[model samples]
Target chain A: MAEGKFTQETVSMTDAQKKAQRSRNIIIALVLAAFVVLLYFGTQAKLGANILQRPL
Target chain B: MSVEAIETKSDDVLISSAMPGDYYRLMKPRVMYLVIFTAFVGMLLAPANINPLLGFIAILCISIGAGASGSLNMWYDADIDAVMDRTAKRPVPTGAVTPDQALSFGIILSVFSVITLGLMVNWLSAFLLAFTIFFYAVIYTMWLKRSTPQNIVIGGAAGAFPPMIGWAAMTGSVTIESIVLFAIIFLWTPPHFWALALFRLKDYENASVPMLPNVAGERSTRNQILGYAVLLALSGILPAVLGFASIYYGVFSAALGARFLWLSFKVWKNGSENEHYGFEKKLFGFSIFYLFAIFAALGTEAVIMRVIG
Candidate 1:
């Protein structure tokens, strides 16, 4: 009978890859912020100026 | 004694190596620019006035929708894109973004743009935007492109819908004027694309994509290009003919159309036998300018009329 040896491999992202990932994260954050702003203004425009004047 | 070793899974090492710019490239910015310009013109030419904020929202939605279609196109066509010189460097083809990532991005943007448009603006425009995305992503990219010579001819409708969608965004309905704008783009597509196909016949052949010049032969494609050019030239003046634009615009369009016809004729007569297909290349370049010039003239005329009256 022969005994087998097991080996484990470890991997890490390069600096370039890390920078790219960080840039993508920043862009995603900016886009989400922009989308929120768009929604706020869109709601205001859709509701119009008399939005707050509704009867309780 | 026993020792334990820790290993990182391959997929877990780097979630994604794609840059933000790579994702932007996947969206085909040039094509999105054209869609945005045409849709903006449509909004301006519309009979009813749109609120400025709403109009900006509409254009943003339409542009994002166009970009989403482009991303989906790159995802589905990545294989052929890798073979074609023109598309070889696209994000998916170059491996900057994986196909699954591109697909997810496209689907997410498509849903977001459509839902936002419906919620912020009107449902009709939203529906048109959704349909346009489907037509481009599924009909044009997934089906027609791999199958037939008439791919662009029919697929052109997907591109033509932006202006109609814009008009609907403003007016909440489709009208003859919008249809005329659609027809202008529809008629212009075959010649514009066929001219490119003539120059890049080998690329289509290598990719097994049946472009007109590849399947129909150069002579037939050239003639068809000339035919479409003639139709496009006539359609270019339709807005003026229909009283939507000034007679001065009609004259300007006529001059541009004549140049288009002359270039098409040159391509037809000379054939693609030339080394560079110079005539075809010239016509292709001119066709882009012709569409832009015609749309710019119409949009400018509308603005002037609104200002004066």
Candidate 2:
């Protein structure tokens, strides 16, 4: 068997850059969560109680 | 000596330093506010009752679509934005966000907003939203803005579509009442923007934007402002004339329209020779209040009528 070789690169980020990246990530996560909530509620409102009557 | 140092020495890695706030600013929150307000008014004035959740979704989609267009506009206009005092500090112009990032952000939001609206709401509203983004981004920002003095006049249609979209979201079709709402904004846009252009003549000239004041000269621009102002005043009272709004709203609209015309007259007569352009500034300020007041009056009347009935 041949041995596998791997290389990893690390880039340094400034404090400000890291903070900004963190803020962006948090916002993206929140937006995605909000979208999921909206989708669930929107489906409920749109389909009403009939949503539960679907056949398997 | 570490991996970071080795990577730094081998090649410079460019990481975006853009904060979330910078991304928000790229969306033109102020303009989005106006779009949301007008769209809300349209939804209220719509004859059909809307599901509250659906209505909220519709407004959100419309606002996101508008913001997407604003992002695209900022992306494409970054060069000119850098030259203009008013827009020099925008995210793209100030290096807080790159143009390519802004473009991708806009395209992604535009597609997302449109698709979500279509799937969640009605397709008609989604289509209108899609067209509005296309009009603002492609027609106005990319083409007409650099090419003609009539850019705002034609581009105004994109801004005017929100109320119609809102109405369509509720009713699933366009109607004369919604068209009247659209016409008010359409007519109101020229005078409002021209008032700003009159005061910012030098900025427009510096940017080589061919604003009416820059190309047709201030005199023509002032005359055109007055002309549009007159049309706007009549259009403001159209809801009453057409019997959609109550007499009280009509009287209120009339009074507001009179003030609009009076200010516009001052702007027209004062000419561009005034050192301060005070009348132009006043007109510009009042125009914002005028549109807001008109839409608010209509919305209030709608709510009152619904309550009374």
Model 2 pairs whose backbones collide: none
Top of the candidates by DockQ: 1
- lDDT (0-100) at residue B26 of candidate 2? 91
Q: For residues B1-309, could you state the per-residue lDDT of candidate 1 as single tens digits? A: 122333323322334678899889988999999999999999989988877888999999999999999999999999999999989999988878889999999999999999999998999999999999999999999999999899999999999999999999999999999999999999999999999999888999999999988887999998999999899989999999999988999999999999999999999999755878999989999999999999999899878878986
RMSD of each: 4.8, 5.0
What is candidate 2's CA lDDT for residue B27? 95
Interface RMSD of each: 10.7, 11.2
Model 1: share of real contacts kept: 0.45
Candidate 1 to truth, TM: 0.93
Query: Candidate 2: deviation at residue B58, Å?
Result: 0.9
TM-score of each: 0.93, 0.94
Quality class of the docking in candidate 1, CAPRI style = acceptable
Clashes of 2: 0
Q: Write the per-residue lDDT of candidate 2 for residues B3-91, one digit (tens) a residue.
A: 65665555433578898999899999999999999999999888889789989999999999999999999999999999999999999
